[model samples]
Target chain A: MKKELEKRTVTGPDGQTFEVEPLIDYYCEAHPTVQPPAYSKIIENLFNWARSESIWILGFGTGCGAIEMRPLMTPRFDAYRYGIQWRPTPRQANLLIISGYLSVKTLKRVIRSYEQMQSPKYVIGLGSCTINGGMYWDSYNTIKRLDDYLPVDLYIVGCMPRPEALLEGFNTLKRMIRAGNAEGANTYAANFDWYKTNQKRVIHDWDMPDYNW
Target chain B: MQQFEWIQIPYSLLTLFIVLNFGLLLNALMAKIAARVGRRRGIPIYQNYIDLIKNYGLRTSITHGIMFYLGPVFRLAGGVGLLLFVPTLYGSEMFSNLSFAGDLILALYFVFFGALGMALGAGESGHPHAAIGVSRGLSQMTMAELPFALAVFSVALQYDTLTISEIVKAQQGSLFHWTLFTNPLAVAAAMLSFLGSMMRPPFDVVLAPQEIPIGPPTEYHSSYLALMQTNRMIFPIAKIVIIMNLFFGGATNWPIFFAKVFLIYLFAVFVGVVFPRFRVEQSIRWFLIWAVPLGVLAIVLV
Candidate 1:
């Protein structure tokens, strides 16, 4: 555990001392719950339609696949026309594109970011590396399967998929959202312990809280 | 002036509804224009509406504190307050909104009020990016507002009244009576300051998208983000309303109002496309050196 995260006593400005546990005090410790769809089917459908049309992607690049995403914003691809926009923060983004191979080290940070995203969020495993580690399969530090650590709603398979393939993958994800098929957030909440165990198995130095959110 | 009537409540709400919708569409339209300049198709005109719905429909929202909750509220209030206080149409009571005696000063206060509220709210989020953004935003806003404040004072001196409606009334009857012709120096200064407030390139260091990851709203998401997005639509248009009334002759009806607002908004968009972004210090210096002197001269000549 980090020294700052450990339980310690500190003196305040008024000279009174109090115990502070950074993890518990600073972050919400309550586990995330599965949020059901809206009460009326019509409303849920409207929400699904809206979600499909406006996808705010978290701009975090886990691996080499991130390079491919740049072209989508360029004049040739222009994914903005398709309602796919990049958001700088995880809090604002609904789509998390794990672009390529995830090492155990990067997976820890990815888990933290994934947990921080609001419910009804999605994970897209991009490139062959996220599926079965691609060329990094024999490496000691790489994660073989992304689904083992997080709920992946879709996969765009390639060593590094072209921008065109990524655009197709986004369209497919949009269809899944509109059809009410993408429920990866709820799946992760339901199988929280199993995913955590698998995550812990590979990440030896799991110094952070069980859930960063 | 006529006595305050209860019927004006709905009348003002009607104005708000129209402005809100217009602002949303105008924003999307401006984005499309910018995209076209880059030779791309850009987002649909209805994209802002879809984005708004998706943000509001987001299932979860977390807050840092009461201030975090109030940040967007204050921002929206600021935008609404500015719009309602300013007269939208010249001589027409139905669209005049809640304009009254000394509304120019009140409008100025409302303009700054939202930023202050946002500063406090973003400060409470405990994000370093938000803090940096708030500080940069406040400093830039203060400097940018100087030229505008000077221009407002010069306009007040030139017209010999502080009421916005009176200012509009004085500018009526002929095109040459418009402040743009009567007080060109003040108009020039105010127009320059207008670029800073519009949050476009050359003056958008406060948001600093690529550098600061969206500044004050860094920690905001879901419904909270939705509220800020709503303000984002209204605030710019609200500011433009003030400019239209003050510089150009105030509009007489809905169609003219829309046209004037669109043209004024396009001025910023045109400049935004032509220029690259400035660093915070550069923008502040630009305002002080170029804009502030014109305002001072406007006041001095008046």
Candidate 2:
């Protein structure tokens, strides 16, 4: 149990050395990994066909852009026509929409949520805030680019992208998913350390481990 | 009654295959119809097929010990076993499957197998949401089952035979002879309970995806979810079939069976699309207030 805590002493600019206590007091285990069994080509094709048709989004609603998302469910925009759905839990969601601006506080939760999701997940950096922080570019807490912290498969640009634009983006995502071209999850895992470093730079007093899975 | 034939295995399997596909189609169609109610283009009728495939194709999985893994097995077994035990067509030998295995009482008891398995599996998964869901589900189930139980008891008493085939034979003479006509009060109570059992709105707080993120299946993913999804499709059909057999007169052929089952399934769908969900206590109160009295009256009348 002693190995669980690693002590670090750091000196502030004033040159006073202080013990750095680990901020994380509680622990919940990281999800265990089981190698997904291999499927034959015929089965793979069937899966691809299915994955293309249905996209269950992790409805995190990180920012104001989430306003646009409501219309997708409403009668006017109706994203269900393309088989798009919103899932409350990350485990059931195959897509994550970083809707609009992400504050450092929310990003930490976003990272945790993303990690909890099963593999083959895709991230959509929605609206200009997720692209380059949009109107809040100069805000202290808002992130400039979502791609730096999360492996985003697509970007839907606009101050707040309209529901129609979001629908168009979804169709493109469907096309990409159908072609078996979305490999963002693999890319994220390969460069996980880099993503963590970037994330930790923005988010301090982090309680969670370096990676969720 | 003890004729154990290997041929029945394949026949039961064949019925399972058909019901799986039919259930998928029925759910997708309901989703489409619900969308139309709001004047929107809904998902395609075949979307459930895609969903089942996509779920099975997920590339990663996390197991929460042994019971979580066995949960879906018990669920599917419950659905298939219940179907196999019920005679599909009164006169057809090939489609009989294993109806000789049990009577109506056995079939009624068999309905709990899946729910018990799910509760155990969800409990072991260690998600508080799952536990909350199971509790709500079991509680709601207790209230829902009471009305159905009374109706079943009344029907059994009315027929004076516990065998399902015998009950169906009793209702065979004319459309007017069906329980919907013969025992209108019991059928009304049973259908209301059917809506509750279907997990439609006002009774769907157990899943409450918005509040609990799909409750019991919150921790489930990939092929584990796929197994549950397969059961989701089959279990409802199995439940509806029993209701149809006991109340609507067992179908004489495949087409009649499809029509009857779809109509019964649609009753839940129609209610789901328009109504908001009930809190657990609210649902319990609602069932006790409205359904329980009808069931009691039906029993008193019988």
Candidate 3:
């Protein structure tokens, strides 16, 4: 744990020490907490029940992040060493790895795929692309924050993160899974204005036509 | 008795040998070229033949249904039918038995069987990306058909025959006899149209890796994948051969025909390097507006 802490300690924009897990904890705390779904504990327990064994992955290689998935699967890093194997179709996969930004066109496809998967499935956002659109924040397409639309269990932060970083993220997700907190509930009831402003900036500007439909 | 006496046995066998050898030779040759461009040390000249023979021995799985199984068989048959009809050289009857009496339009539609098979197989895969790619491939083909039809129509009118062999026979003289000189704009339009038809660069959006890994080849594996790969290796050579027979006289020897086709192929690669792929809508619009008009003009002029 001390070694993990040392790796995460870094200077932030304000020149203050920022520890990664603490920052994540703070962010999670800042958001409003909603009650877990009906039979929530059962879902949570079931999520934990399947975590340790046979971690089947539906790794959607959408963008540059797809290249990162190669090392994880191949001999060098060998994610299968941890019992993680890539499933061809989403229906058989336990975890959905959204490897990068969700283009509007691709997003529809992703949603359909997500729906097709069996229940007790978890989503791991691969990089900054899934978290906040990463470097493509200014692009006309791409969803800004994955959390706005789909439930993301883990946000593996990287601007094209390294293989080691991916392993670290996987470890973190494993820890979370063990805690019987697998089902990620959307805590915030409504932040319509805040989300709308971000959506406007990312998808369309004020100059674009306001279809209003 | 007289008819039996008139029949030339060795001549028929010679034609069979020529065609069987031609198909084997060209498929072997293009596999090397594609491997080289893809930056691999490479397969042996007969590697495709070995692969094809090996495919028959593999354990097969047919989950997606009948369309998937039927796709490659149809494509192979169509390719063979095309090879028979398109005249490769003067005074040859290589594909004479299968080559129905048809024109350039008939020849164009002949190869579309392969594309249709690929599209149907892709749709049956149950992968959204493959389905999307098939739709895009179909649309791109529709766009390309216009200018290509027009360009070939001009050639047909110039020579007054739809038979490719007749066209080549008519162009037996010097460079000036080629239809390429007769209408440079039509040639340019046809070549642009060919990019989409061939699914080469600037029109390779249907198979973009970043968006969709390989388009139709996405779900294919093992023997199914091998069949599709063979179709790709043969399809380009067949198309290039048609171009040669139409414009340049089909060479009686290898070097001249290969040289002309290579130059056109290089021109295609150069064009790909210069332009970026247009979106599906953009491709459709450009083909309809620019290509169709040029085609219609060529047809009118012819």
Model 2's CAPRI class is medium
Off by over 4 Å in 3: A1-213, B1-60, B93-100
Better of 1 and 2 by TM-score: 1
lDDT of 2: 0.85
Q: What is the lDDT of residue B29 in candidate 3?
A: 56
On the 0 to 100 scale, the lDDT of residue A183 in model 1 is 94
List TM-score per model, in order.
Answer: 0.99, 0.92, 0.54
In model 2, the Cα lDDT at residue A25 comes to: 30
lDDT of 3 by residue, B1-302 (tens): 01222234544445445544554566555434553554443344554444443333222223366887777666765665565556555544432223333446778888688888888887877678888888888888887877887888877777778777677777777788777776665676677687776665678878875577567656664467556656665566667778877766666665675577666766666566567787788888988888888877777776
Off by over 4 Å in 2: A1-42
The DockQ leader among the candidates is: 1
Error (Å) of candidate 1 at residue A213 is 2.2
Candidate 3, A104-208: lDDT as tens digits: 666655654554444445778888988878889988778878877556788888877888888887777777766745554232124434543544554432322
Chain B TM-score of predicted candidate 3 relative to the true chain B: 0.80
Task: Identify the leading candidate in terms of lDDT.
Answer: 1
